[model samples]
Every structure is written in structure tokens, then in C-alpha cells.
Target: MKRLLKQSILVLAMAGMAGCTTLGPDYQPPEVDVPQQWQSSLTEASTVADREWWKLFQDPVLDELIQQALENNRDLRIAAARILEYAARVDIARAGLYPNLGYGADVARTQSSRNTLGAPPDGVGRVGSNYHAALSVGWELDFWGRIQRSTEAARANLLAEEYGRRALVLSLVSSVATAYIELLSLDRQLEIARDTLKRRAENVDLFRVQFEGGVVSELEVAQARAEYETTAILIPAIEQQISITEYNLSLLLGRNPGPVARHASIAQLVLPQVPGDIPSQVLLQRPDILQAEQDLVAANALIGVARAAYFPSISLTGLLGLASAQLSTLLEGASGIWNAGAALAGPIFSGGELDARLRVSEAVQQQLLQKYLVTIQRAFSEVDKALISSQKLREVLAASQRQVKALKDYNKYARERYDEGYVSYIEVLDAERRLFDAELEYTRRQGNSYVALVAIYRAMGGSWVDAAEAVADKVDFPPQDAPESRHWWEYPPATRPAAQNQP
Candidate 1:
């Protein structure tokens, strides 16, 4: 009996100390084509990135509004809450590695009627009172590493959620910047219209005196008044646009429609320089890319968890306590009791349940792999589109500047011709119309140029840093050509939570 007891103890200890082999496929990063660099006509002004893009225009008001939106944006707040929720999930997943110990106590007094078959009877004797106390522990040994894989997957999910929140933050920041630029453009347009209105008013006064002195016709005086009123009409239109844009900006800040304060002009606005970093660097900084990668990681981890299902799950459960029928003997040495159990369970027949789960996990991993590739494609597309947009807007601005200059010259010539009686009022009106349209066009393109710069910054990943070396953190994974079937053990054990990426 002593030899058998020693052998049993040896067997149990060996089972406890033996390393469980994890059965699952390894993860591979999805494949995607990314250009090494952007090709464009615009100069790469990497040094000018030191200042905020808005400050390039020297507009303090525009800067202030963007800051306010960042602080008050409700969408951003909601996204932050979601990140925290995922953080909690990560904590829950990590808890699986520890034993679950619970302390329980019970005191019961019972009385029963006369016996039926072997049942006891209250009439035979007073019902007994029982007291029981126990500390129970149950721990599923991670011999097959199912729980470890699950924990790893959860950690990846937390990271993905974090990056998702950062993506939302980036979007919010861009919206605020875009709206403020538009507001400034509108302000500039209003100023231009009012200035033109004042000049036309002067022209109207001069034309009236000329007509009264018999130097010009009533048609000339009427045309001058029409031009002045036409310019005055644009002021209100521009003002309406300003109101709408301000309200739109207020909404972006998660506020009601109200006035937004800013101090900047299109002329005063500064343009941001294009950074010269290769597009490849953006993959490391962009939040959407990281989020997609983590999603792929979680899908990969689930495969291990599913594959491990094929192996028997080893677990230990035990209870140590004192129980006594008499209240006086409950805590006495004679009432001590202890129990322990170990179980290894594997499915013999589940009608393809395990196979189905394994296949499902693989299929889902493949799906996320495609989505991951798509995200990379999207990131590339955005950068290219922004590059093309900025280049074209810059060209348009240059042309509009020339057009504005030419229109000014034409208007001056028209005024001189009218004063010398060399042209009719219709010619002067045409020149004034051209000049006004040219000025408005030039101002809009200027704002668009600034906006295009914002797009470039976003596409280039906007200065947020991250720490991830490939996907796995536990053990080093061998490099593979593709995302097909790969070896496990490539994932590292240590994980960084997503919240650490926040500013």
C-alpha cells in the first residue's frame, strides 16, 4: 500500500509539472503591396513640419477652434470609452491563467415529516443542524495552452481597439482643421466683396456727376449703380456661408450652432510642407493599419484555441474544509475533511463540432487577413490621393493668382477707357465681374491647398508612435512567404495594452 501510494503521488506530480504541448497553427501577417515612396511634382519640404499646419497661415483663431473641438468632441469621448471597455476584456482574459479559489460556509437546520421509504422523520427525533465550511479551488491546467492562446488573443484585441480609438481621434482632428480653414476662406471672401462694394459705390458717385454734367449718359449712371449693388449682394451670400460653416464647425466640436472665434486671413494663412518620409513608415504609425493587424492577430490566436480542443483538457479541483453534524464539534480536529480530484476530458464524438470549429477559426483568420490587406491598400490609396490632390491644388492656385492679377489689370484699363469715353458701361461691368470672380476663385483654391496639406498629414500617419515588432510577442516566429499554414511558437508571451498608445 505504501509503494502504491508513492507511485500515485509520483504520477500526479509528473502530470502537474509536465509541459503541455499547444496544438495550433502559427499566425502570419497578410500580404499587401505598398509603394516605397510617393512620386509628385511638389517639393518635399520636410523641415517645415515643425509647426502645426494651421499655424503656417499664422491664424491663431483657427488654431484655437481646433483645440476646442479636440477637447469637447463627444464622438472622441465615446471612442475613448470603447477603448476602456476592451481594456477590461483584456484583464478578464488574463485572469484565466490564475486559479479560482472560493471560500464557502453553510449552516442549516432541517425538519422532515415521517419517513417515506428510506427517508428520515422529524417525528422520530428533532431535525439535525449541520455546519459546513470549505475553501474550494479549481484550476484548469494550461497544459495545452488553450487559455494562454486565448489570453494572447485578448491582448491583441485590446491593442486593436486602442488603435481604432486613435483613428477616430485622427478623423476628428482633420474635420476640425478642415472646417476652420473653410471658415477663414469665407471670411476672406466677405472682405473681398465688401471692398469691391465700396469701390463700386465710389464709381457710382463719380458716374452720377459725369452724367449730370452731360459727360456721360443715364445708361452709364444706371450701370454704375447696378455694379455697386451686384457687389453688395455678394456680401450677404458670403455672410450666409460663414454662418453655415461656423455652425458646422460648432457641431464638430460637439456644440450647438454658435459663433466660433478665430483670427486669420487666406493671405495670412501658412501652407504646410510635405514631409519626405517614405510611405512605408506610415504603416508603422497609422492607427487603422495597427487595428487591422491586431484583428488578424486575434483571429490567429483563436485558431490555437480551437486546435487545442482536439487534445484532452487537464484540470484540478479540490476542497479542504471542516464539517460536523453537531454544532459543538464543527471546528474541532475530529471534523476535518479534505478532497482532491483531477480530470482529463476529450470528446469522443461530437458530430464534427471540433472539426467545424477548427475550420471556422481558420476561415475567419483568412477573412481578417484579406481585410488587413485591404486596409493597407486603403492607406496607400489615401496617401496617393492626397499627394495628387495637393499637387493639383497648388497648380490651380498658381493659375488663379495669375488670373487675379490679369483681371485687376483689365479692370484698371476698363476704368480708364470709360473715363476717356473710349468704352461703354457694359465693358466696365464685364471687367469688374471678371475681377471679382477671379479673386473669389483664387481665395478658394488657397484654402483648398491648405486642406490638401491636412489630408497629406493624415495619410502620412500624423506623428503617433507605436511599439510592435511584427505581430507575435511570446516566441520569435520564423519568416514565411505568405499567410498560409505556418508554425506556432512565433508569438511572444509579453503584451502591451492598447491604452499605452494614447497621448
Candidate 2:
């Protein structure tokens, strides 16, 4: 019997190896067109996007805020937890490739009457007891690679989730930097409003005195007061905007709505360098694009799973244990028992359910393929848009600077003409109004230039994102609701401790 059992096992192993044939299409990355060079380029600045580009601003406060956001942001935490979820699912899918072993034991007593339809002989009274115990195993042979295909799809999903986390980190870093720049801009605007208001107040005082001395008319005093009130109104509005920006930035840092620290003024922050030599193919490394492709890979593998379902499923089951009717002889060697068998099941007719499933899988594959292609196209478009904006915004800022300088000189000359009795006070008020508006506009464009730089770095992802994520990983986030007690299957010897929290 032992020899026969060994021969049966050997034949099953040989048949499984010989008949293995994976079904459906294998995954291949989709190819899409890429441009040779960006349409708008900045050739003068060094390539800062290859590394921690946010540090180019040289603001320690900005750096600290970004680090804080990376560690505490809720979105990032959710993404990390999703990665763990997918990892567990991968293990669940791979489990089908191995045998499922279980144990069972039971004891029962029964009483029978002679008058029953079926009864024991008269010599045997009516009461009886039975005991049984067994170690059983059931395994499905992968002749058509259904389990392999399912495992493949699960692994791809795990990769996609990992990339999704990295993409969130990239976005978080850029968002913190952009918000900081905006805060500085608002600060500068508030300063401009206050300074204009102070100067206008002095004008109102002087014009009133001249009117009382009969050197100026009441109309001139009224005009001066009107200008003063206009400038005064701007101060509260600018202050309100500053408060709103601070509260929003505080939220981005994953803190309660409150003030955010500022290390440098708008003019003090260094501008980030825009890298011009980026190749079009480098966009493939963007985490969002990579995540989308992984989704496509998983979808492609599901088609194989659907196709494999059409073939026959062969399973082997075995039981080896003891059974006895007498309680005293339950464990005796004579009571030992064993059994083994094979089963084959296949679809005969499912009312078109199998056909519909296959069609659905194929349709999902097509949808993900289109999404993958569209992601690449969007990445290219973003890079081009950021590059063009960065280059043109610099020109806009420079022109605004020139406008402010020209308006300052105009205000100075107009004031001199008014004091020398060569022009009316209206001319000086016009000059000052223009200068105030021009200064505010220049500050706004200055802030936008920095924001454009952030956009370019974000659009052109590279090794820098990995470096940022490394910093984020240093903070050991709590396990996502996973129990501290772990099963043997959850703590596989093949996986590293750093891979998951098994216990």
C-alpha cells in the first residue's frame, strides 16, 4: 500500500508539470509618442529638479513645514495604509497555489429501537457510540495556471498602491512649497497697503491746513480726504486675505487652523532653477503614470484568470486518521484508516455567465489601457504648461519691476512740480495712485514666478521624489488596524520584517 501511494503521488506530480499551460495574453507595457524637447525652455538655469528642488528656496521654515506635512498629512497616511491592504491581498491570492491542510475530530452517541425501519441485530441492543479524527488536505493542481494568474494580478495591484503613495508624497511636497510662497506674497501686499495709507493720511492733513490758511480751496481738501479713505479701506481687505491664507496653510501642514511661521519675505527668498535638458521619456518615471501602468498590468492579468476559468479544475484530497466505535479502542493501531482521491470539475453550461465574465474582463483591460495612455499624455501636457509659464512669468515679473521703477520716478517728479506751483495737486495724487497699484502688481508677479518654479519641479518628477519619501518613511506610522497577534501564514519566512507588521 505504501509503494502504491508513492507511485500515485509521483504520477500526479509528473502530470501537473507536463500539462502546465498559462492561458490568455501576457502583459506588455504600452508604447506612446514622446516629444524630443519641450516647446518652451529655460537654458540658463541649472537642473534643480533632479534633487531636493524645494531647498532651492533657501528658506528653513519652508523646509520644516514640508517635512511636517509629509509626516502628519492625512492623505499620505491613507495611501500608506492602502499599500498594506493590497500586500495582504497578494498573500491571499498566492495561497491557492499551495495545499490547504485542516484537522477534524468528533464524538457522537445514538440510540435505536427495534421497531425502526432500519435497526441492528437483536444481539446488539440499541445504544452505540462512535469516535473519529483525521488530518485532511485538499489542493488544486495548476494545469492551466489560474492560481498563477491571480497571483500575478495581485502583485501588480500591490505595486500600484505603492506608487500611489509615492505620488501623494510628491504632491504634498509641492503643495507645501506653493502655499509658503503665497503667504509671503500676501505679507508684502499688506505692507504695501499700510504704507500707501500712511502717506495718504499725511496728504490729507497738509491739504486741510492749506485750506484753513486760504492757500488751497475746500475742494482740494475733500479730494485729499477721499484718497486717504480709499487707501485705508485696502488695509483691512489685505489683512483679511493674509489671515485666510495663513489658516489654509496651517491645514496643509496638518495642524489646526492658525498662523504659519515665515522665515523670509517675498523678496528675500531665492528663486528655484528650472532644468532645460529634460528628455521626454523621463516623464515615464512620474509616480502617477507608473501607478496607472501598473493598474493596466493588473487588468491584463485578470483576462488570463477569466480565460483559465474555462478549463477543467483538477483537485486532490486526502485523509489520514483513526476511527473506532468503542471508546477504549479509539486510538488502537487496528483502528487506523486513510483515504485519497482526485476530482475533476468543468463548466458544462452556465447560462452564458462564463462568456459574460470573460467579456467584462477584456473590457476592463481596454479601459485601463486607455487610462494608461491618457496619463502619459497628461504628464507631457503638464510639463509643457509649467515650462512655458515659468519662462513667460519671468518676463512678466521683469516688466512689472520696470513699471514700478518708472512710476516711482514719475511720482517724485510730479510732487516737485506741485510744490513749485507749476502743477495742481491732482497730478501728484494720480502719480501716487499709479505707483501704489504698480508696486502691488510687481509683488504678485514675483510670487507667481516662484509658484511656476514649483509647478515645473512637480511636473518633472525624478529621483528627488524618492529622496523626499525616504524622509517621510523615517517616521514609523502606526499599523493600520492590523491585529498585534499574527497567524503563521501572515508571517511568512520569505518576507522581511520591514515589509509588514506581522505581529
Top candidate when judged by TM-score against the true structure: 2
TM-score of each: 0.83, 0.92
Tens-place lDDT digits, model 2, residues 1-503? 35544655665566556667888899887778888888775766676677888888899999999999987787877776776677689889989887787899999998988887888888987988899988777889988889989988988888787778878888989988988999899899989988888888888898889899999999899889998998888888888888888887787777899988899899999986677777788889999998898899889999999999899999988777789999799889877778888999999999999999999999999999999999998999999999999999998999999999999999999999999999998999899999999999999999999999899989988878878886666552336566776443233222326645221
Best by lDDT: 2
Q: Write the per-residue lDDT of candidate 1 for residues 208-311, one digit (tens) a residue.
A: 89888998889878888988888888888889999999898899877999998877566877776665555465455588888889999999999999988888
Give the clash count for model 1: 11
Global lDDT scores for all candidate models? 0.73, 0.84
